[model samples]
Target: MGKTLALVVFAAALLSAQAPAKKTTAETPEARAARIHKQAIVVDTHIDTTMMLGRDGWDFMVRHQPESGENHVDLPRMREGGLDAAFFSIYMPGTVTGPEAVKRALILIDHVRRLTEQHPNEIALATTAAEVRAANKAGRIAALMGMEGGHMIDDSLAVLREYQRLGVRYLTLSHSVNTNWSDSSGDKPAHNGLTDFGKDVVRELNRLGVMVDISHVSDKTFWDAIETSKAPLVASHSSMRAISGHPRNMTDDMVRALGGKGGVVMINYSVGFLSNERYEAQQKNVPSAELPRVSWEKIVDHIDHAVKLVGPTHVGLGSDFDGTTVPDGMEDVSKLPKITAALLAKGYSEQDVKNILGENILRLLEQVEGVGRQLRAAASKSD
Candidate 1:
């Protein structure tokens, strides 16, 4: 009996030793998203926190909570969000115009530049796509600027040129109201899109390598500018009208046309832009504190819509941070990694997500710069 028991124990030990090792499980969606998001070069083309620089109790170095009413786009949250570059929107109210507009614009520009200067170790001002890439390689954030309203140019080509010299990259043709030249979507048509001078402005922007933004322009002006400009355009912070039904959002036709030109539509995160219901409620004097928050999924819906219409290469995140009310779970920039995960869950490949994150805008920048060089060379030849 003792010999039989010993034989059985030996057989069991042998069987255990011969068993194959356990198979490893495939990567989870969250894990894959985290890895891809970390490796990707993330860029948000617009944020409106430059005007908040130097305000009481607001510091870009410290991470802020949304409840504090402090502005977004701080260095800590930017790093947390894996954001490599962003275009700081230097915005003045649509009412501010003429020389006063120019003054406010300069002040805001100086504020952002000074902040970058003060944090050279953490961030650098990037004027070109190459500079943005270099800044990413150096493990620092790239800070770029865009003038939010055409009025900032003060109706002077000289002012526009000076702004370009000052490193202003894209010009949003109008704000809430029509500029002296270009008409706005928020107000009644004035010049019926772009005037003769408006077309000239688009040409100059092309020559200067400044991207023409159609975020607030009327449909006629948008069509006019798209036709007038030699390079691709950027709707820096707009959403899909089909889903949200906001007048400010772009129509499906607009996305198709813009994508045909190789342009991108960086989806906006403002609740107003994402949901017509919320916008109408807010407009009806409903207190925001009592209103339900807009879901973050709406951003992905818009992104998916644009991607399906124009492919993934023509989509990106604009956020419009610090400029308006963002959707839920996106109260701060640090939650940006969620965007990557959401896109993955929606069936976007890693490469597609990468393109939507930053590559598309970088390509747009390069194309804009290329168009400028070509136009300048042709002009020199004519001279």
Candidate 2:
């Protein structure tokens, strides 16, 4: 009895001496990393945040408190999710033509500037990749601008150059409409792709150090831009066609070519881009759960494909929050940690994840800037 009691006492003592494993503190490196990613320079290259800015009943910076709603982005939500940067789209509709379209573009650009001016401490305007980093370091949301449709420039290189001067860093050569020079992927094969002027836009963008976003351009236009630009291009918000055969998606060949060119294909988080079932269900207006997820697994699959094509540096995230309905797993900007965890599970090192999260985009932007600088120098020498 005495020996048994002694053994029991010893066991009790051992248990007491060992402290229970505590939950990881939010302040821990892992927690901080998750938090930083949520808060870090998470950039969504395409968001229709400016769409609501022109409307009377909408406010962009307020945290959306209502649980049931269709809106995907808001300032409070961004704060909660740690969203540090985003490209507010001056997205124009194709219906407006000529001078009217240019006017609308200006209105949208003004609205974006107003939003930034109103939220000076919380947000700041950023034109270059360097500005994005500087703005983030200063603990402010970097509100970069991009013109979604080339038509917004009114078919004038002067207008396009003006938009660039107004802090626009990238221009989507086509936006579901065929421009005088470039054809859109949304339209059936026309113009056989980009015309000479379309190629000029690419050249000018490269010379100006402005990024050429191939999203929404025709496959031919996409390839043409790739061949024409002196700087690495980006498909700002697109997905791999191997997973979902949407015409809007980049084909395996395109993905491979983009990787080969050292360009980054930032994964689009739209459900339609993630899975075939989801794309079909979305087309059929089916509810979400019934639709397949571009699960963290599927996202990894795209990243894996990118790795096979481009060797990892060419893949990045471009969650189209506020622009379109994203996948369920990526419902909001806040759920980015799940992506990090999923990436880790897929054997992506911390460095690789970091690159995917934002580094690649930064590097590509810098390349564009470098090209712009060289062009300016050459122009000056010629003068």
Candidate 3:
């Protein structure tokens, strides 16, 4: 009986050894997202970080929680969130005009440039798509500049040229109000779309390699600018109107047109733009006291809708951080990874996620730059 038992044990051991080891269970969605997020070159095209810096005298090198301070972005949080690049906005309120507008834009621009100069090892100012990649490879956050309103130019193409010379790569045609040349979504229509001068501004922006941003423009202005622009456009910080039903959000037709033109619509995280229900609830309250809660899932729904309207190549994250109240889970810039996880859970392919994260904007930047070079060469030949 002992011999028989020994033989059975040996047989069992041999069978176990011969059998292939059981494969490990598939990685959890969260784990998959984290891995993918780390590998991707995430970029936020619109952030009002400079506005906060100018207001609170906050240190860009130090990380501060939103509850502790009004600031939402800093070096440590960016690193923690794996954000590779960001466009620090030079935002001049629509009310500020004439020399005052120009002065405010200059001050904000200087502040952003100073941040990069102060943190050479952590961040570098990038003017081109290649420079952004280089900054990423160097393990630094690529800093880019975007002017939030065309009013900053004050009807002077010379001022626009100076802005480009100062490293402003994108210009949102209007802010919360209409400018002399362009109409804003937030204000009463003035130009009805874009004045002839508005079309001139688009041409000059294309020639100078500056992206024409239509985020705050009226529907007529959005269509007009895209039609006039020689290069791809960028709705730097807007969401889907189909979902949120806000004027601040782009309609499905606008998104489709933008995609056809090779432009991108970077979804905004502002609670008002993420959901109409939440926005209406907040507006109904006296003094806008309490806001209806919105989740990260709602933000993802906007992204998914944009992808469906226009392929994944025309969608990206703008965050609008520090400029507005974000959704519940996305209280600050550090919560960006949650977006990646959410997109993956929603069945987006790895490539689609990468495009939505940063690749799409990079391609747009390259194409815009190429058009600028061609226009410049033609002008020089004519001269």
Candidate 4:
């Protein structure tokens, strides 16, 4: 009888332990968001905060912790968003060209270097995949530079190499303006595509292990880049034109091609990149050419579309915050969690979401670095 009683007690104890515990409160939306966000490796590809640092005379670190104004990114906001890293654009304005544009690029590059020098603890200047990992381990944001226009080098491969040595990892090849070797999507008459020199630029970038970014190139130029580049390339801040119909956006074919090459198409969070209607709406109010371009919720929709088209591997985030106008809900970098929640609702797997947030970018970075290593080995053998 005593043995029977003890067995009953043991069973009772096991049952009690197995019972579902009651929550102190229901899992709040905020709490769930925090949990999911912590599991992701968030990356914003194209934040233009450097432009603010240069043009607006804004500080990047704590010395001037300005409120989140029209500006969409700050160091604190990045921490809040759990952003792993970002490509801080050293975007040269298209209006200035030749010597003036090169001079401007040099000055901006200096500004980026100074900012990194000033905030060693808060940010690290990354030029390779290894540096990105080291920066993440150091608990600081990995700040990498991407030259937004090929014009910045003034058609000089030597100048391009100089920028690369100075830590510029990717070159957009063109902004809104056509270069001596390539026509932009924004350029009229199209020039058919990349010139012979443009092809040389592609080869040179591959040789140097620098990424070829196709954000503002014409469709012909886009295909040419894909064909010429031995290494994978990225559209650091582009959206699906199938949804928005913007020439500045990538078509479904382009996204698929990028995926086929094992590259990433980071969705730009510009409202204009999201929907044709939103773009037309803004165009009416603002001049055709101006700063502070705005984006909206449809931005998430475009991201969703890219993922759907190319599965998850091809898509990632490039918010274009501070560099261009962002959408309404994503007013600042801290609001990145909202995108996470939206992505979750759309039924993306946690691994896929994490890849879209940052992993794919890391993969592309590694690929570029590998190409760089190979080129050097070949050159050494020749020597």
Which of the predicted structures, 2 or 4, would earn the higher lDDT when compared with the native?
4
Q: What is the C-alpha lDDT of each candidate?
A: 0.91, 0.80, 0.92, 0.83
User: What is candidate 3's lDDT per residue for 285-333, written digit by digit as tens?
Assistant: 7355556678978889999999999899999999999888887788788
Cα distance off (Å), candidate 1, residue 278 = 1.2
lDDT of 4 by residue, 336-380 (tens): 888777777777776887888888898898898899889889999
In candidate 2, the residue pairs with backbone N, CA or C atoms under 3 Å apart (3 or more residues apart, or in different chains) clash, namely 36-40, 38-82, 39-82
Residues 1-383 of candidate 2 have per-residue lDDT tens digits of 99999999999999988969778755654664674465435676777778878888788876664336547678877777666788888887765769999888889999988888998998899988889999888888889888888888777899989998888888998988788788998887677778998899888888878889999889999988888887888898888888788788999899888878778888877767778877877789887667665664676677777777777688887776677766556667666676766676677776777778777888888887988999989999999
Model 4, C-alpha of 37: deviation from truth (Å): 2.0
What TM-score would each prediction reach against the true structure? 0.93, 0.87, 0.93, 0.88
**What's the TM for model 3?**
0.93
Model 2, position 5: C-alpha lDDT score? 100
Which window of ten consecutive residues has the lowest lDDT sum in model 4?
Answer: 61-70
Kindly report which residue pairs in candidate 3 clash with one another: none
Candidate 2, overall lDDT? Answer: 0.80
Q: List the residue pairs that clash in candidate 1.
A: none
